[model samples]
Target chain A: MSALITCSHVDFGYENHDAVVDLSMEVEEGDYFCVVGVNGSGKSTLVKGLLGLLKPTAGTITVAEELKRTGIGYLPQQTRSQRDFPATVCEVVLSGALSRRGSRPFYSSAEKRMATSAMEKLGIQSLQNHCYRELSGGQQQRVLIARALCAARKMLILDEPITGLDPWAIQDFYGLIRHLNREEGVAIFMVTHDVANVVSQADKILHLQQKALFYGTPSEYEKSPQGRKFLGGGDLWE
Target chain B: MGVIMEMLSYPFLVRAFVGGILISICAALLGVSLVLKRYSMIGDGLSHVSFGALSVAVAAGWAPLFVSMPVVVLAAFFLLRITENGKVKSDAAIAMISASALATGIVATSLTTGMTTDVSSYMFGSILAMSPRDVKLSAMLSAVVLGLFVFCYNKIFAVTFDESFARAAGVNVSFYNILIAVLTAVTIVLGMRMMGAMLISSLIIFPTLTSMRVFKSFRGVVLSSGIVAAVCFCIGMTASYRFSTPAGASVVLVNLAAFSGFWAAEKGIQRKNKGERRL
Candidate 1:
């Protein structure tokens, strides 16, 4: 498969210090990639860099032309305001088509269909008219995933997607993501600290601590020192 | 009926109603995004900046709107920069700028205009203050604000809901944010002539909060807030005419009443739902 994104010695930082240094990685189409790191370990910085929200200070990070045009589907962590925001599921889901709408003032019929199909795929079509704030944790994640799908058909980048979810909800979320990645051929790039649970599902793993400590298949990651230390020790690095 | 006809008989009152209702609708439309984005205080800050600009215009013998419009718009942009840079907390920045502007306006007014009724009218707002020229200008600018809000409704909703996701989706998040700020600045400047600097922010905050108490969707809240604002403005103006009260204060009181009523009704519905679940 072709590489959807390639980062060559990328450095992301503020003025004084670099948050992510000399990071080299590649995300292939249909790859289920997991980036595991402790707090402030530059996982979010890397996500921002890949999403083009922040420019890399050092080397080049190239995105495939098609991926660049469609844009990476992004599921950012929920903010305090979003928890109480007054938006219907349909409204939130349809907003994902904003990039495709371009200069158009309203969504085209095709865009609306994309949103509807996204909701149906996530089994949220029934909840389309419901208030977003009233949904449970799993339902909310499903709505967000549907939104991400509307933005890009190729790849999704979720930052700490399972945070604040119950154990059952977490498993359901993983199942949904796995179905999207494996069954639908949609590439998954997930950043999380829940390495113990997510590592089993992820095809490839990148362990980061301001740099790449490990990058390989999950089996290779399990064998590596960094992954063993992180996964073996319960909440030690977290 | 007689009171309504008598109020409509006066030309100044008619202009006030036309300008006030249009401004109210514009404020409510923009207020949804602002209140959701936690930038509700922007209206208040920009109005203070407008007050300063008006005082400076008075000192320089320039038309108030002509001078205040550009100054308030610049202040809005400056406020956006300060908030985005994260060098200072947004609330602190707004408070500092607004307080300084208010002080500067007070000093400038004392030094030149000497507490004139024109200045007081801008501070407290008077129904008689809506001149034909002011009403015409307010109507034209309100149209622009409403048009832009409708044209960019989806983008505004996306940006307000999630800035990072919107940016990731190639939605030009910063551009839309700046657009929100500029539109809010214009709304504050236009409403200040009728709602006063001290109370104009209420026009941007109250209706949305009231609508949110009952409405569960963004579109619902936005539409409801517009209706709430227009109704409150009409009731407030009627009260002001009968009671000889300040127009700005009267409208604010009416909004406060609506907010309380909505809050109570929401609580009642929640209680009823819980009781039904218990059964």
Candidate 2:
């Protein structure tokens, strides 16, 4: 019912480069916010700003104080380097709950239970002891999603989660995400290149182009000129 | 064999074996993360930095460990900075610092009179030289390294795997990265007494790479590296005693042999897998 995150006139930049400028948006509780943008449109930077990783060069951003306590789970886009990391699925997944463990040196029994439950939820319990690199792309994504689930209670911020998945795998991923949003009530703020199918599912669409271009419901996005131009005038998801 | 057995009873020889084992285990544990992160050369750079500090300390007639330890740790921290946020790239920064420090150490050694023997002892290393005080220091610091490493294992794993994701999840990536560099500096300085400045980085490189040849998981590689490093150190120390060779060179030679053996084993396994696929 209340806003979970708020960004007002935020400008995020790295030295001599402003990736995001005057961006303003809010993610409400239970909101499935999909941010769609072209290359170098500051989508990742905006997410970083929201996640408190990047400080705003201007304006302000606020994350709920309570959510910061339990911690937000982040699923970054799988990079080539991450794919080569020599970690077991259990090890990788266990690290997802690291922020929640406080100054305690090791993972608590409850944290291990959370990791196991997350893996089971993502149907990756069998891969717990297997090496992460040995898994297929779809399977790896599933493991990573399970890992993210281990870190949070109500929300997830996924950066290009289905980047390398096959079409069928993408559909299954979408189905799984939809289930999380609808069934488990987990809020999702996903950065995606896939703008079509998500149009029908997203509660809000924030189209970013070096700035926030559109911030409204999906129905409004469909009617807006910028949305029509970006979405190619027809439903491409079907 | 009887003479060697009698020699082993000497307190210094016992200290050498105990201190060397602790040093090797510490080096292997830290080396796994450094190897995985592609920062293995930082160990070499930090070692050279320690060599420079030791040379200066010896030239001034000060305690070498006291002088070198902090300097090496600071250099490691500086390297972390250069790699993490500075303009210079990580590998280039390592090379530059190592070269400059080595040059300084050489010049400092030449400037000091009647110290070539002292310089060689540090440069080439001799396990027989570890006094009780040195052994105690090595053990104390090594225990710190091992304890912190195990305690922060999950945090370190997360930081190494996806630094950006870890930071986003509220993990202090820089803190852990700095922790690793500091631990490595300590290990290198202590190991310089066992493996020598000329060859110490091998302790940080060989074991992890050898383990990676046979293992696919991080824990697997860390555990295997610890075993490989200890085994090689033992064999090397024994060979050094038996053949009267330089300690550092012997340990390095043993590690090189282990690396080659692992390489051959990995290749053989790959070939067998290929054959099975063909069938």
Measured by DockQ, the strongest candidate is: 1
Candidate 1 residue-pair clash tally: 0
lDDT of 1 by residue, A1-238 (tens): 9999999999999999889999999999999999998999999999998888899999999899989777888999987788889999999999999888888899899999999999999999999999999999899999999999998889999999999999999999999999999988999999998999877999889988899989999888887778878888434454
lDDT of 1 by residue, B1-279 (tens): 788899999998999999899889888888888889878777788988988888778877898888898999999999888776774488888999999998898888888868788788878887876778877877887788777768888888998899988888778889888888888888788778788888999999999999999999998998899999999999999999999999999999999999999999999989999999999
TM-score of 2: 0.88
The sequence of per-residue lDDT tens digits that candidate 2 reaches over residues B1-279 is: 775586588888788888888889888888888878777878888988988898888888898888998999899889888776753477887898898998888788888765567788878897776778778977897888777768877777778888887887678888888888998898888889668997889999899999988787888888899999999998898888888999899999999999999999989988998999999
Worst 10 residues of 2 chain B by lDDT: B81-90
Regions more than 4 Å wrong, model 1 = A13-16, A65-70, A232-238, B116-119, B275-279
lDDT tens digits by residue: candidate 2, A1-238: 9888888998989999899989888888888999999989999988888788778999988888777776777889886667767788999888888887777888889989999999988889998988888798888998888888998968999998888899999999999999888888889999998988889889999999988889999999989887887779955563
Task: List ranges where model 2 is wrong by over 4 Å.
Answer: A11-19, A38-40, A54-69, A163-172, A196-201, A222-225, A228-238, B1-4, B86-88, B113-121, B264-279
Candidate 2 lDDT at B227 equals 92
Against the true structure, what is model 1's DockQ? 0.83
Error of 2 at B131 (Å): 2.6
Q: What local distance difference test score does each model get?
A: 0.89, 0.86
Question: Clash pairs of candidate 2?
Answer: none
Best by lDDT: 1
Clashes of each: 0, 0
